[model samples]
Target: MDIAEVLTLADDLIFAKTGKHLDYVQDAILRGTLEDATYTQIAQELYSSPSHVRNVGSDLWKTLSKGLKKNITKNNFRAVLENSKIYNYQSAIVGENVTVGENVTVNHNFNVCPEKARSPKTPQNPEPTAKQPRIDLGDAPEISTFFDRKSELTTLENWILSRTRLITILGLSGIGKTALTLELIPQIQHEFDCIIWRSLRDAPPLASLQTDIIKFLSQQQETNPPNSPLSRGGEEIQPASPRRGEEIQPLSPPLSKGGLGGVIHHLRSQRCLIILDDVQTIFSSQQLAGNYKPGYENYGAFFKQIAESCHNSCIILISWEKPREIAALESHQKNCQTLQLNGLGESAREIFTEKGLSESEKWSELIDLYQGNPLWLNTVAAAIQDLFSGKVSEFLSYDSLVLGDLEYLLNKHFQRLSDSEKQVMSWLANQNKPVEISKKPALLELSPSEFLKAVESLRRRLLIEKVQKGDRTLFAVQRAIAEYLNS
Candidate 1:
């Protein structure tokens, strides 16, 4: 039975006993219980004390027991109601097996107790009190070599604790945005009721992504496992043991039906931490940063709702490009926030030390050249090891940037640029030094306004660097990027 059916049962039973309908707290408790939430989680959601919630639950359960003239308790309430839904049958429980209709079919190795019996887990049985939220870190890479980002971690924690509803960790590929988030999860998972990490690398449509997430967050488990023994039109039904990992508590019903509306309901009711990685894939290439691709524009509305709505949940977006709404909607006291991740500094020496690179004194020069990007440094460090036996000084003697696998990484970013952006990048690559905007080459047929817009776009994309010469603003591409373009 779903939440509504259970609630109707509760109301009918309670009203018959006391001639009073369920109150607000009573209704909230039923919703929380149906979702497999602990009393503490429900209490926190309603800003009420756990003791108070338990007190109300106890009184309510006693009333139910009187109305039914049968044993009814918190753990068994759902089971009793569900069992009542089954068609007329001759049933008996023998140890871990429940037999129906003359023992023609037996559900073996299962928990079939109306009185909280324990064996192989089934929906009717009560599971242990849950302290951890349900987690699904799909395709979220493990942090094998995380460089310290203590400050960033602290900032993210503070924002989440303070109820920031939306956060975007923005940076170029190879930066430690994904790494930092992976590390942060262990430190904060206990604070939420559900935590999920999804990768947008494949750019799954919003509806598909939303549906997948809803299914995970849902209290209702998926359809029968391949081993389920029951089929429709057949009288006998056998509930099988959990096919996956440890058993999940059975939900009375899902708060969400499935879609944007369903998603928002779950977010508002449960404390969820949703991490969306590789968000750039949902955005259009060859355009300014954060413009969603044609079919993906609805993500803007979804993100805006996350930021504008009053909810206790949090959504974290990890991307190479900042979404347009991020700059426009974020405020000092608002729930929306953005973190543009930069490179690791001295902490990055660990990558060199791990790579067995020599000339510790020259490591900083190499790090500075690669802008302390972890993946870029790792790629170059390997080339240095193969070509120069891990000698930093020997590699430096060549005075040429080492971009082995980095070329592929850079090419991925290059492929996403607009024509204006490409022309600006080409111009910057050939420049001898940082030059003022007024000194554009005549051959680069762009007007002043177009040049400035392209430069600004590239800056937001982290493809070009800005410098100050006297009082004039100067811009130039990084050596590795320039070399990639020039090559």
Candidate 2:
């Protein structure tokens, strides 16, 4: 494959497993090695010492091998590449039909390679464009400029293809669950005969959804030109709807109702994909109790019916928390497969590096403080860009991030905890050393029993992790959790 396609594939592979992008060093080393450049030559080209080049090469090999689910070394990495379809990628640069591996071998004149210039890489512009304004809404309020979520996209695609009956993505707010779902749709559109995306915020009544389904199915029939009675063009060619007395129109191609009942009637036979965004807003337990309080509506039965009946169609649920009914579907202790998205990875430095800090140590510290949440990373980056005018050294010397809207976004999630819980968490965060909870109860000003209850609650919620040292179980809030509480 051409070098551009090769880079995209490499990105896809790395992101698919680790949910992180390839850093610049990784990208540069991989490309350099692919072109058969020795460590010394690569060092010269990349402006690094030969030893640094070798270390980067070693790290790249380990990262790629782990991501690709196979062992790979620089010597064998190219062999694997040659065997993969990406190696045969076609490139039409200046009307030259150049197959990546055949026409442009990596050896003798590697520096003159055209693929190096055409690689699909993030630009070196370190700062976010001025057009992207700072926005702060609850959950994912801000648009992250440094998003590198390739693996999550790949995993979503795999879920669409694999034999799994149902796939649910569960995570806390602002974790990029929605962003990841939207990114995967365009890539996997061809896999499904029908792809219907709906936001549950304004979930129509059952009748409206049923009617909408029939209308959608009819449109599909017209496009595919299936031999069904409903397939007829009108004077102005209006979209198809089931014949008034037809009762149930078949859903699949060459549609026939084989007891899938009327709702799915014709649509059940084909491979379909339905994505429900913000499912938590619609699938609440309180809604099913017939209490029409604001957003309460029992969608449990609707979900259960769809899951139990549909065979070829896969239903994707994206929610902040798992709905009870969906969680109960898995028999035994095997819970439904849930992909809990965390934060962006350290590789985001490649993005920051473009704005102009090439040093790894400085970038590592920034990523550590932000924990690599794309939105947060971008926010701090914007502040740094504005404050220092792209001076990486000056930016690192600062004590705190401006945090624009991140503080408010974090407050919403943190406010859900009880007052005592917040207080205990803050205490743990301020402690200079790991405070043994059993003995340090007086320091926290909580009775022994109450302290135990509060600590257990935090652990259950995954806000805190217990560090066991001999007989003492010291408690500390997780970095992200602590940041939210402290903010």
Candidate 3:
């Protein structure tokens, strides 16, 4: 009867009765009730009026009561549900007038009764349930609040289920890349034999990281080692490619060295899900995006090997920048893909509601203004609560954008741009509307090549907007970013 299970069961029952699933407000009310939250607290959390919450809760209880064939009230909801569950479990019938227990018998006779049907032989050894995978979430942050990402989670799950070996999730900071991936784990973790989440923020060398991961994966092999040469102090014998005229590349794995080859051997040994976070840390700052820092160049090779080597495991890289090889790999290999996370759409209204912001109608305007980034919306929502007394209309009345604390975040993104890219951003920031960039503008200081490169780089960083007007492509900077630069 935990909140998740209760909500799921309630939702299913309600759907069965009404032919419709529970709405957001109803879901919120049920969750709030489970936590013993007051109507006032629930109203404030949803930015709803107390009257509306009460009316909805009243109707919801009545619906549940009718559906469950029992009296259901807000105060006694938990007890009613528990009793209903127990009743249903005991009422289930395996056979007519038959009791199920030790040496149970059926009173009714069948027309054809085999020997086993008369006296079923019991199994001497019962099959055990499958064990959960070993998981090590190193330094992974806990998600305090989660917004809806059902579509994103489904897409990621489909990719993993299809046996794609390498996935890189790219997004602007605060766009919920980590949150989305963390949410994805539960949906897809059952497909993996082991799951490991590690952060690359400290820029661990490729060899060291490889060794660390290999050490962890080797344990799965130790517990369930195959009767092959691998565990007999010898090299593994790889299976031959199917005779379908498809060429297969052979691998020469060196288990002794802490290198890509060794990592591939362990990856091939089991179905593991390895997540490397903060991948942008390994790239150099003040340079074009995704250029590796000095002495970190080997990571490019490691990534290439993970994508190219034949293995059953998946490696997910989370970062703010897309690595250079990703595009080429995606075009060349079916198992390699990149997902660039972006701002939310209508779903973002939930953030304002959670922050107790007023004027629900104006939320879309505010979400659009902040580009629908979850963290950015949360940040701006707090600002709206503090400066405008939670009035969205008043915040929008100012016309000009405000970046009270968002400036620091913008600074981080701008600092990563090269000189040419910064110039392009400055130009874009000064423009009042989205501009056509199909042709090089005379106003920009850079040459044609430099301008195009900068524009491409800015697009990759997700710092600029891309729009279409008739037959032309237009680009524009977000109002907040422009305000930051102007300030």
Candidate 4:
């Protein structure tokens, strides 16, 4: 497998089993030339201390070994690599011809031509290799790392099993959207005859993207147009090797239909699932100023087509923020499902306990404080282990437990709010129960209209819950976010 594909698979494996994110050091190690470098060399290259590199390498081996269901070492890392077929190939296109897979071979033999014989040309230089920084992957969570996200997993499974052509998961930043999506890959991968995930993080050129899609799907290179110019910016475009091919056609125009109508034809005929995660960056509205920092233009229409037309295959969109414009397209024919995820449940206790924390005297209070936000729990748990010499139960009683990362975990979400908005939210959080905005507008120093608007925005973001009593509407922050603020 190519380095990119291997790194992607390794990352997915590490993150899926373990709820921990890969540190930058780990990412660098995975992408670096691992064959020749020693731990000390890696440390020097990453500008980190040697001990840190050693630790990262040790941890990475453990994680990979666990994921592969066997022991992993530098000697066996290559063996583990051979056993996996997760991302062996991709998709591509040529003129009107489209293909899927990689490593396509062209059988071409040429005799010396008169034109070639007539001219003497200087030899061209080979492209220079980039000098990549060294890093250690051992510092990241082991592959066996796991979070308690049963509810979110179940929700994703339900949506996948639902007869919906399109399902969208919406939430704010760091809300576990990526984690949740990665977690689901293993569970649902077996259900479909084929499963493909494409990251729209860097929205490439449309033609280039289409080429990649076709290559991954068709498994062969489509014949290019005759005498087509292969050089762009003075660089020659090399032909790609071919793999397996499944014939398909693009869906009919109005193109909101799955952009891969042609591709889905093959998948539907064979039964498959396609996950397009973080597609929000692609579908985000370009009209909004500073909205999506450019390069992503008019992708909403593309997604609308995928949802409306693709039925034989499932297209899942995992995104931080929902495209509000999609609400209009909700119709009988289109099965567009939206799921908003929250924090972990009681199961998180198991996660913490497994991490070596003892039963807490104030179990409920501690859990309530962290609200079982998976990342926060791990961060707090690690901090507790590193700092506290006392038992977990005793540590719970001290303010130090609350003062560490747990406090920031709770406050991070609140800190995202504007000063005026946070003041309003803080007041609501401190309330014994829900209070009508009108009853507390003076407390926040906002006019009635402005207070109402702020409340609505928070509610839409799922930071707060709203209730209606007679003619008045009361707003309260969700118990989780509130606990953070009140903590």
Clashes of 3: 0
10 residues in a row with least lDDT, candidate 1: 227-236
Per-model CA lDDT versus the true structure? 0.74, 0.54, 0.74, 0.53
Cα deviation at 342, candidate 2, in Å, is 2.0
How well does each candidate superpose onto the true structure, as a TM-score?
Answer: 0.67, 0.52, 0.68, 0.51
Candidate 2 weakest ten by summed lDDT: 127-136
Model 4's alpha-carbon lDDT is 0.53
Best by TM-score: 3
* Better model by TM-score: candidate 1 vs candidate 2: 1
Model 1 lDDT, full chain set: 0.74
Please provide, for model 2 over 422-472, each residue's C-alpha lDDT reduced to its tens digit, 9 standing for 90 to 100: 667888877656667655455566677766766665553345656888987
RMSD of each: 13.6, 17.9, 18.8, 21.2
Q: Cα deviation of 334 in candidate 4 (Å)?
A: 5.9
lDDT of 4 by residue, 246-335 (tens): 222221222222344555444433334566665545533312211343554445655566566534456676764455545555554436
After TM-score superposition, what is the CA distance of residue 213 in candidate 4 from its true location, in Å?
3.3
**Residue 3, model 4: Cα distance from true site in angstroms:** 40
Write one digit per residue (lDDT tens) for candidate 1, span 412-457: 9999898988998998899889877875567778887777778878
lDDT of 1 at 465: 82
